[model samples]
Target: MDVKYQVFISSTYNDLKEERQEVIKVVLQMGHIPVSMEFFSAADEDQWSLIKGLLDECDYYVVIIGGIYGSIEEKSGKSYTQLEYEYAVEKGIPVIGILNRDVNRLSAEKRERKKVNQEKLAGFSELVKRKMCQFWSTPSDLASNVATSLHKLMNKNPRLGWTRVLPKEHPIEEIVQTVNVDIPKPKNVVSNGILTERDIRKVLKKGLFDFGSFIDIYFIIEGLYSHSNTETKLPNSQLEWIRKNEIPAHLQQVKEIWTRSYRCIYTFINIRDLAQKRGVPQDVISIGNIFISYIYYVLTEVWGDVPYFNNKPELEMAPKGSSNVKEIRTLSLANLQSVLHDSTLSTQHVDLAVGVAVRWELQAKNYSKAKEYIDKLINRDRYKLAPVHEIFSTDVESIGYFDTDQEGSQFHNPVFRVLCKKGRFVHYLRYTEVLLMATEIYFHLSDHQKALYYINLVRIRNNQPQLKETGNNFIATLLDDWKANLGMEGSYFSALKRNGYAEKVLGIPAFKSVLPIPAQEIALNPNMQQNEGY
Candidate 1:
């Protein structure tokens, strides 16, 4: 039998209205039907019954504890929210609690009530010996923790029963231990006495120079180079030989670098500074810088050109591609956009910047702005650039040029029509697609006029006739038409997400629509925060 799980939100209405809303938003984002008291009138007994039934039917329960507990008498003494939580626990449902850290600083009466609630919760935890509940300090934290917990719960087979149920004591540690089993070490370990060809082969076979292990290898090399023990030191001649020609020539030399140099073990910041002071070229530092920058561009959506090392200035620079640096002295949003619009600029360079800008705007939720840039690419007559698909999707291998009959298929004799005939220029993102995105954003923001305008613009560009309007219902009609025509082009997901229409159409929350922040960012910046419901 196959069944979808429901999540019921239990919270004190008086104290946690905002938090409850947040949780509901998260639930909706997660594609689950959220059951809460706000959906009903204050005095509706039928609503109360429905809520209880929802609680009973729900596969997971989220109990939000705020500053004050609602009076059972006011409807008051203990809250219906607390009672629902108790009921959920009694029914053996998976329950998680979100408690604000500020609860400790409440008024005396409220504090006393909070204490009682805390005692009751503690007693329940002790009695049940279940690690089902967790606390979060902030709304964002609550959302993230809930998402993570729910994801773990969902991935495990329910048939596994209580084994998958997390216990409260050292919960994170337990989760980690479960996920990563200890690998026993080999009894016969090799000492670092001699650099055997076999040892070199083993290390090289592991592809140990990738970004992940580069730092570890660098540190190991550094330890070998900077040995302080005179008894175990190599001669100056050997040290000089290693310094000049230690790293294998076959290793991929540094291609590009970013601003982050501290992470590179071979690139010592202080040593580089000293070298600069002595007016000497630091080849190792330069290589490390270029490699890191290339990695940064590949991993993150950073706007502007791929940074290059400027030998004269001795700094990483984003020089305008194939243009005189003196003429394009400064870089700004307008400058970048103008460069993208210019027909003279290399299409590859323009498209590179455009792609980065598109991603940046999408992340910042500036869909209209993103579309404007995209429009320039698709409507190349207005700007001198070629149509987006002509430039970006021109790769013969990508569209399978040789896979079909030469006379029957468009892919058979495909030719590059955008920017230049030479294979150097390619369009990364197109204008029509951006317009589609803008339309979706406008629809989501409930600005029907803008949505219709952008959608009709695309239709006109595609040689489609203007859609006929039937009074106020015209917008909905046009929306349906757009979906029918452009739905298969990857616009459906964005439209549903931006409009908050996913809950009704796909039975999922909008929170699930967003991508999570890179885990590395979280590790680096403790103050940096994750998105809600992610």
Candidate 2:
């Protein structure tokens, strides 16, 4: 049987220091624990008790009788080293005693300085010699000799030694404590609103561009290979900041994003409040509620958590566990459309509202709810797949502007036509995309029949043939549709993350599914912690 013996190394402190170290090295290499004077305290009563305790626990004793008689314990009238050796003898510990081969040949400084000390040294050497004494001229030789002797002693004595997994007096929890990381959430359920001129203009403005561009650049790096081949090498520090998914300090002229977003949300609420106080139109309150909801959606996507309750912006962050993006998106749409019924909300705005709702529901993984929003636009039959020419078309209409058939601008689609004047249909959503999303949802739901039906609906719209069902065909079709329609406008990367494909697509680890909080933000806010990987 194997055992790990604790072998006590006894020696004069000054002369045998090197030899003790060498013995410890050899003992450790042989899988035994070495105890020695190096770890002991003074020659007092308490230390004597400690030494006796150590001797009692040890499996064997080592007496290295060098040239010098070390300091004496006054009570015992013997060098402490000799006292320890004798105590081990009384305790019946297996002893391996080593002697200097040429003690007389050593220099005067290496030998005992006083006559009494010299006599004590000679007596101690004689006592150790009474056992099976070993002789060595050097530390190395003594280490090797004592190792062989200790092994024999251990086999002869046959006592149990130290081991792992021994029973303890207390549980493991007594010694160690664990701390958990804080995760953030989204908050504030304002009676949410639909798309409006004020909301659109605010989204389009410069103050919000930093926040929007933060998203664009982030997805650009994370989705680089999805569209471009430009290799990006950034310093770890800058990369860490980018990983926070916030605007980098160097990219901004001012850190006004938080204030701007806050002000925008607050201003809407204030306007709505003042209007109510003045007995203004009910549509005014609807506008405030819907914008508040939109702001909540934006903040949730950007910061992972934000607070807005009962149409109010709470300054603090929301708890991550409490967030339910699906419920928020679902409830907000109802309030938005209800407000619309009381006002003349345009078809384009209504489509945008539902498109946003579809997006949020998908993000929340509420497939059925997302499909509800998708079907609304699909039932309307107003949006369709952009023709091949329309998709590949230039941003500007052809020089012959009179040609109604000419290629058009990149912003005319029902979902994405907000910025386009008259050029063509550039959509954030189209009938084909809605069909693809339905296909994706059903595939996730394991309804292969419906998945196939919806996928073919998209295929026919794109003037392409229906896909043949096979392993991973749904994913292939979804990617194909993304390539043909939503080509590289920041949605592909998000979709990849949602489907657990970002690691395969972007070569990033799964723990980095979200960007780290900005390093500066973390530095400034002690309450915030970086996301796991970053």
Candidate 3:
């Protein structure tokens, strides 16, 4: 079989962009794929997880060092390039290191100014020298050495690589191209041909739904056990098993799925203006805006500060910047808030904005603002609490094979239905959730009467007795209702965290409130800081 090896190029990005591109070209010219951090935003755990997955899959690893030592991760106190090299070594992957012969001889702009980074770079260079290494002084020379070194590495210890029985032919220019030139094509044009209105609509629809499909139900299922004293809580052993295996497996999957989903959204955004001009429905184009705002909200909520791409869709192709969580939240809020009074928006869109606004304001502890948004939803009279039986189900479609049974029968395992299954609508916002949100907001505002009134609506709908308590009694009643009604819907944990019950209920440390930025991410970006206690 004809095979092509995957070569992962590790280096500091800004200083070595051109040189990395040159090396990438040589790899491509030799008929192989080149993987690098240049195509990723490596500042979060998800990104780091994805990087490790790529490194695990690639056939060989290559490290190119320049004057700069690159970013250092706080946890390990080592640069990301060094971390990548070490990981490759630990994994027993073949490594080819290219070190600059003399940093002192390089231009001042290209040299490290900080005394600390200089020492670290010297040490790192020595470490690389201990392995199969080469010396390069310039980009062209580096590319030549990479081509020669990779050839030797492949011949010495060949591995199973990607192969196709019948590979599609490419044009001569595309095959021989050394650098990416953004030759501007028609706004509606794509790799194949003109992006027709049908194509635009189809992609937008997929982009809108694909994002919803990416929401893992495990997050919701895990939330049900987040609080203490739940009968359904997984045993410590099962929880450990999930943390060690399932979560990481899904995280890798989520990274891959979300990466493709973002590209789909980006494609729609890039051709949106043209699609609109081409007479695609306004509703179709509107999906792009709605998808982006909601995605930003979801991403920031999970990843703290993610790489912002909506404002600059081009960065999706070549990411080089970071976004603050708060700023992205503010933008998403503004985008949603702006469309509240939009005459053209559908009721579903309007309600989505209001419900999300309520959650956002609640997250910020602006209870009064949250109440205002919730009132817009409740006062409209279009929504009402549904019976618990109507809203939830006990149907078992497929059993999740979590074999806690020592004898191999998974009869006692918890069966979690796939949330991303076709035609299954994952509820992002629900009327009952909004009702409980109103209850909390009203309680915070010291309006016990309104709080009791809203909570009673859901309680009465579910054939449960109304809550007649005030003060802490009312707080307890409201929280119980939130868990009972919104259990496994992904909102209970947020409610616990929001109501200051996480520590008391979950018994986790305050530092565990936020997730840690992946060590590789911090190592890649010197300015990036890890979360507290990480």
Candidate 4:
């Protein structure tokens, strides 16, 4: 497949506007996406989050330092340009730093006047020099140098750039048949006439199966989960959704089915009442509660403060009022706990409930509760760590693999390699994650020996040298291991945030920590409140 990389163009706006334009044009000529801060206002306190997210998505970062210090972020006391560069560096995005060969030759309008800014500019220039550096005297020189540097970078380290998936070849008759076929109405929707236990089972199976079929769910979750890893932070925008072309359509498909699935669950509740009247077992109703709790957790985590349908599934079409994220998570955990305790709960659901409980507790920062679920997962003998060699196997299920479709192509996790279309076996939970969580829990409780013991399990399993008990900076060592193991799997960034390394490691402001509710969501729902940060 032909790949088109996203190349971020970073520079002091006013001074290097011409240079940036040249670089953007070059990137376009190279058939790559050129991202910049043109659409964002640097004065905005939360712009860093958006900028950081943009950089995260970009395959290459091009930093052009002219004379100006650029717009400084008040919180970090660093220019947004510098912040962007540092974040890209922190995330290990390949950078092409171009500096003005002689800033003294620049016109008065292009040079920094403040002594402090000049000092900062000099320091920043030196910092960029530590990486891939190219000197330029003019916009054209900058463009030429950028083109050369980008070519070298592309040749040296190939990134998983974006590519359009073309339609597969089919027989002429197949094409004709497809063209003649009428579009089918959605399946798995709970109809208005589901009055029996059989009907409930049919709808539940069909609806949940249909809900699960949207490969888009994996994509959307991967994109949104970027917030947790140092990938994408803050609420996503219409632009972000558009930039990721597949997102909007899949998102719509998911929402449509997701809403229908909710309607089905509500339909199930009514059937439960009928079943109660008939003296039939309410096992399905209990099972439905497990799914509902999971649904609430997913919605709240992905989009904070979503419209929750509690007692009224009929209001599915009505405008949804926003529900508090904390409340939803708390309720999901409580419901999961209640469901897990039921005598009729099956072995399969017990596993599912424990997994959900672990995630919810982790989100809640209730490490103790998270540890309990994790312990149950460990002791149940339902899963075991794969041998070190099999951990990266595309077909292996021993270590971790959710939704392992035979048709689905797999790639190494981006953390270990370059970003690509088939980035890793997109997994939700892993045996290593469980071990790491145990490590974190023990570390939290000040049990150094236990923490080391748990963390070493992962390292030893992977055939890597283990961290010694005598090693200094155990937390740092553990953090490095956690990041390496889970990078790009949708958990590293959240891990950083949860472990208090986000502000320090991510270098983001405090307010940016909480994702801003996407503006489009608020616009669509007048009742939705924006998060604290813009």
Candidate 5:
């Protein structure tokens, strides 16, 4: 019932006949109606006129170019195909050209005919070069190329440029009023000495509190809360009772402590100094100490932590004690790591510290050590940490303590399963990953046999079935597969860096491979200097 398809085909009779036939067959295969003069015999003037009308009405025009020039009729002195192509161009219709190479490679007389044909086709080539017309070298390439181009063109969003245009009588004042607005200011204000509820809410909302403000507010609140005697001191409660009641409360407290700790550490240190000057409660000072210790552990593991505290003797004079109420200030990664690794550290405390370290190491791009610590923490049974995927999965039954679908459904979320739990620690590094890294190093060192052995070892674990033999090409393929599969697990970037491929693969400038002195650190200490590049 519907007149669905249409295309106009134009080509020289002598040279492009075969090519044009191929194109017509393809057009039919693509489910379009084709109109061409070649399909009809001579002496059909009525059919010829119908074909010309179809050519003008059809959706697309196809031009086939071959070696031989089309014949010049004795009286008209112009080829019908040439005239059709010119008309199509003049009408601003989309045209596809197929050039037949077999016809191009012909005898001298045929070549002369081709030269004449080209002269007729010269304007079309210019249009094709300018991207106004699409051209294909062969008939086979035509269908695929045209289909792909049309698909892409149809999928592209049409840009709106003239939607605002209207009759000259339209009111401009209404449009101007719709686009303008005035900024508003908050009504409540507080004095600088003490933070009011509104001031606290504002600071929290803006996320503008520095480390000093964090320490001040946290310590001040913690001091008042600790003295308030809100916690029910349960001396003889059973394990089950504690788990059902006291433990939940304890966990809430721990969460608050860690949240405050994180904010204090990340915001900068002048707040802690301010807290000390203001004579904040001892437990409040301990919170800042513990936060600093956690940060130091992460920095040390990743960047070969510098001993800034030891270098500054005045800072090392803080009290040293095991009580949570006292401020024990030791500034060194080694000290921080030692405290975290200590067996006597409470499970809750160690879990919080390890979680912070893992997060920091990952953020600092010290993934290797992060993996190592995560693996250690996960393997410990007392910690009750789960497997990475199990912890991160979106299946409601399997969602770990840290998993949240706030951003979207589980399927669309980007956070890894293992890292989902807020305080749940998991072992990240496996022996297989270490072996893979070693294999990559061996490959770089040109120890082909050793490299193949290690690569095949990992492949076997992955159930790949086959063992690769020693060779450059095999190693390259193994590396390619490794990068593809092991990527996002945090290996690809490190491998790129280790193998001198960071610049090539990541587009990282060569100077960025090494750590630079942070601008703030340099500003604080005149002795500090930046890395080679800013």
Candidate 6:
């Protein structure tokens, strides 16, 4: 399988543009994705969220601590370079630091001008040395060190990433074509209404999906849950979706309100039963939980009520009389626990399974269990609590993508492009949320000290001082941190949707927290009804 990793590059952009380009080249050559601030704007609050998210998704973090102190965030008075390092270490990501050998011999333009920034830069470089790091005087030398360092750390860390689904396949090709596209709105989405694909057949899309089909389930799941949409619905357009103090009503596709939705959920009971009967490997059987876990969570995220404990393939109407997400979550936990017991899966795979359960606990406001699962998610040896940058020469695919094909511009997200093209497996979980969940769990539990302990780790990682107060203000900060780190990763959208903030943010009243059943479904089935507002 062709597996690629995303690396975040953090440093001053203008000065080290050449060095950044070289680094990006090496990462691409090695079949990894390089994410840098070049794809973002320092002034945009929305882009900062993406910056955090990219850092969160990356497998390895590399720090190029050159002479320059880099750009600073006004609120914190700390350079992003320093803050990036803080986040990478705080997150427990493997850190590989490369220094610009013999600092004094460097050209004056590349070095820091302000005395305070120079001092800060010196301290940051020293901090990188506290771990396994290297020194390089030139961009080429830096590339060599970076390649070797990342190579070693990958063998050591081995994150849950995509592999080739087919045997002896060529690397996934990046087709950069200039083509105009009008992103289509999802059809059949009514205001504040849930749109579920009628049955597992809707999920299979007129294809066969028996439990005994072990060899091809992963491909089927990946095809169904692609991050890219058939309709080209934008994912995390930082400019429009995540702005502060401003609701972006225009960017939203008027699908649910003016149109309708066509989506689906499958029964976990059948998948489990079939896998067991087929005598599939525990790993394969367990992966089914990931698919089902996602389906359960997405339904809960939109509707807060869904059918649970159903052995039947079709769930036409939601169960009546108190079938909240809590019950659905309990069933999910039981199913995932059996999957977690097997030793064949990777830690990332196991953590991925548990993280969804924690998300459910948070959604249900079950703080204690969220805290417990979070403890299991964070590993001192396996995860990191900081940010690292794999810098790029330009923002080509990372950001600043307003250019349309009419003007002959092409855009691509390296990660998504690769995963959809040649990658194997369906990985829906983001492990960084474990720490963020801990902070929220502790905050809700009124364990201020513990809450600050977790929140401060991320705060201090961003080169900001700890919060002086550990009250609602601290919790507010924690939520912002959560939104920033989680961004558009489905978690944030779901969180906002679950809490009825989507109506507020999207500037639509009928945009209810729960989606309404389609009018057609109501006609076909007498038991079906609509959401309250819709």
- Best TM-score goes to which candidate? 3
**lDDT by residue (tens digit), candidate 4, 463-483:** 889877835577667777876
Q: Quick one: ranking by TM-score, best first?
A: 3, 4, 2, 6, 5, 1
Which portions of model 1 miss their true places by more than 4 Å? 1-335, 338-344, 347-379, 382-428, 434-466, 470-492, 500-504, 516-530
Off by over 4 Å in 2: 1-303, 306-344, 391-427, 430-432, 446-450, 460-463
**Candidate 6 per-residue lDDT over residues 1-534, each given as its tens digit:** 446576777767777888888887787667665666663445445556556666676677887878888777888887777777888889888788888888788899878888998898888888889987988889899889888988988888888643322112111111001112222122322223332222211222111122112112222222222211232432454323322222211112211211111112232344344445546456655766755665576656555564443443233334233256778788877878876797976666677677777777787788887777778866535556434231122221111111222322122334233322222211234434566667777777888787777777767666778876685466446656655554433455454543445555445455344444432232222343444654
Identify the superior model by TM-score, candidate 1 or candidate 2.
2
- Please, what is the TM-score per model? 0.28, 0.45, 0.57, 0.52, 0.29, 0.43
Of 4 and 6, which scores higher on lDDT? 4
Ten-residue segment with the worst summed lDDT in candidate 2? 177-186
State the lDDT of candidate 2 residue by residue for 344-426, as single tens digits: 54565565566666667777888887777777766764555555556424322111111213322212233122112223322
Every candidate's CA RMSD = 22.1, 24.3, 13.5, 15.3, 24.8, 24.4
lDDT: worst 10-residue window of model 4: 175-184
The candidate with the higher TM-score, 1 or 6, is 6
Q: Name the lDDT value of residue 126 in candidate 2.
A: 89
lDDT of 1 by residue, 179-216 (tens): 11221122211234342333222222122123323322
lDDT for 401 (candidate 6): 11
Count of steric clashes across candidates, in order = 26, 15, 0, 4, 9, 38
Clashes of 5: 9
Q: Backbone clash tally for model 3? A: 0
Candidate 6, position 472, lDDT: 42
All candidates' lDDT scores? 0.42, 0.56, 0.63, 0.62, 0.42, 0.54
Stretches of candidate 4 off by over 4 Å are: 1-199, 210-283, 302-304, 313-321, 388-403, 406-426, 470-472
Error of 5 at 34 (Å): 65
Which scores higher on lDDT, 1 or 2? Answer: 2
